[model samples]
Target chain A: MDIAISLPIKDETLLPKLTIGDKIRVNGELFLFRDQVHKKIAENDTDQLDSINFLGSGVYYCAPTPVKEGFLIGSFGPTSSYRMDKYTEYVLKLGFKVMIGKGYRSDDIALLCKKYNAIYVITYGGCGALLNQYVKEVKLLAYQNLGTEAMQRVLVKDFPGYVAIDTFGNKLWK
Target chain B: MRQISCELFSNTLKSLLFETQYFIPEDVLENIKECYINESDSISRDVLNNILQNAKLSAATKLPLCQDTGIPQIFLELGSYVYLNFNLEKTVKNVVNIVYNEEKLRSSCVSDPLIRKNNLHCYSLHVDIVDNESLKVSVLIRGGGSENMSKTEMLLPGTTADEIKNFIVDNVINMLPYTCAPVIVGVGIGGTFEQSSLLAKKALLRNIGQRNQEKFYSMLEDMIKQNVNLKGCGALGLGGRVSVLDVFIETKPTHIATLPVSIVLQCHSVRKASKVI
Candidate 1:
């Protein structure tokens, strides 16, 4: 069944309902943290990340471009998820219940998701312009100097995606 | 000798970069439309539909088709009879820097490959002075997704056609989910190791459905296409019969001792544009 899930879900309220291959529309605040942010967090320079409670939050592996005139954000879409797989365990261990990007994650990442009872969703990989429609607002939360790699909070509305890994550890990508 | 203005070169290259980077070419768009119609699975159809919608949205909003404008490579065929007033290389670099660094596009160039600094946008420039008087410039916007996921192998010179086909189809299937299928697969066979890789990358410039002139290679290309699609990686890796939009095979004579093959994957947004002066 198709599901519409709001982001920053608390505990496992909406996560367990998600199963691998389920097409879902997710909206609400998603923290845009990609490679650099993960590196900073690993380096212990938590900066603005520590102030936020990531428990049950969804992190998007996306980097933003310059906002065009009359738009809230640029063509911000999902990057390949595997590059960030190294940080998946760390992010999940820190209490993230949802993560989103494109393509398959490491098998270990799927197991970690099950261990944390979290879900991983896959969105259109390179369709940045179309994905931009779901983004309503954005705010920089940390690392503003990092250009597109900075951490930000983006509020999306009815963004379409698929559950790549469900809470039970079932995964879509083989 | 025909004299071409440096400003004309700079201007033409600038506009081509700006326009082609945003606009999905008609062939690619049409193929995507076909994929969308043919996609049987609901999820894969949604992904293809989103790609179609993205093309329209990109055209209307002036937003980039993809955020990673990718590494911009220029292939120039300079006519021997043509002369330029200024340094063509410097002008090309300047135009590329401006186009990629502009607000709409992402500055993806990691200047020092070892240092990994994204400051310098590398101009992968190739020049071939042709005998004709008409100068041509072509740009290939190689996205990181497909480029990074590509594979190159140096196989035994005795490798048979089936062996080559198996290697290609297998790798393309594995790369499909990651490289953002439905993609354009460019295969470079023969040539030296480096030349084979270059041939493969250049093969991506071939228009979709354009086949090799030789019957053997063209048939090999068709076979590779059928085999990869039969594996069914499909669009967005959602599982269907059209993962690969097209396969381009380019071959060159190589030393009898060594055989090289390169598989270059171009994502659905095969951003290629050209102009003749």
Candidate 2:
């Protein structure tokens, strides 16, 4: 079944709604971070990273090109999730309800998603041009020197993704 | 002997970078379309369609095909008789800096591995001299994903064909969706450690559908392709029959005691372009 989800991922209410192989389109708030941001956050406290107080939010692993004159964001796509596997457990424990990226997740991440009642999504890799269509607004958040790897808060509408790992421990890929 | 100024050469490099990043080359597009048509799995089919759509949108919008415009690699096959007016390497870097700024591409290169400072003046260059008088310049925009998945192995002189096949298949399984399969696999065999790896990277610069000139290596390329696709890693590694579009092998004579092998992966968004000066 296909489901449309809004930002600020609420309580465990939406946990049972998605299953492995389910199609989903997300709308609302998403935080963009890549390897550097994840590493920095892992070394620091969650409070230092917790400027935005949202219940359950999605975090996208992306490093986007610079936005041209009039565009909201440049071509953006999910990077491989496994590279950030080391810091995922630390970040997920902090109330982030969902993770968005391409490729397979580490076993530990899948297990954590099940335990924390969170989800992992897979967007098509290298489809940055098509993916940018969903992004409505982008605002810089932190780490300006990191360039594309800097954290940004984005507002997206109908961002297409597939549920790779659900809260029930079911996974789309082995 | 023909003479070309550095300014004209840099201008060519600038446009090639812009063209390749935003538009999928004709040969690569045809191969992907063929794979999409032959693929039976719905998931892979949908992903393939999306890939093609992304290419079209990028061209129409005049935006980069992928956000990771990556580190630009410029390969120059210069003629021994040709004359150059300026420093080739410096000219390349200057052109890249200007083009990067004008195009608004991402600066993904890190200056030092440990400190991780972004290097805005990064370019991977290889220059070779051919016997002819004209110069040929080729640019490859390599993304970080497939480049990270690339591997190199040095084996004993007595290693068998079966061993080579198994090693490659194993690596493919390990990379899975991360390498962004339906990739072009380039294999370099028989050179020294560093040369073998360079050969593997250079092999990816070949035109799609181009085959190894030697029959023995060409057959090995065919064998590797069959085995890789048999794994069914498919497009995005979700699942499909066509895991690899092509496999290229470049070989050089090596010492009798060592057999070096290297694999370089190029994802489906293969961006390669060339110009003759």
DockQ, model 2, C-alpha based = 0.77
Instruction: Residues A1-174, candidate 2: write the lDDT tens digits.
Output: 468988877757886689877779899999999898888878874454666764698999999889987778998888889998899877786678889998887788878888888999998898888899999989998888788888899999999888888997787873
- What TM-score against the true fold does each predicted structure earn? 0.97, 0.97
Which lDDT value does model 1 have at B199? Answer: 88
Model 2 segments more than 4 A misplaced: A45-48
- Regions of candidate 1 where Cα sits further than 4 Å from its true position: none
The TM-score measured for candidate 1 stands at: 0.97
Q: Distance from true position, residue B235, model 2, in Å? A: 1.0
**Model 2: TM-score, first chain:** 0.94
| Model 1: docking quality category | medium
Per-residue accuracy of model 1 over B36-152 as CA lDDT, tens digit each: 888897777888888888889888888888877778888899999998889988899899878866746877666576655555566688888899888898989887777787778
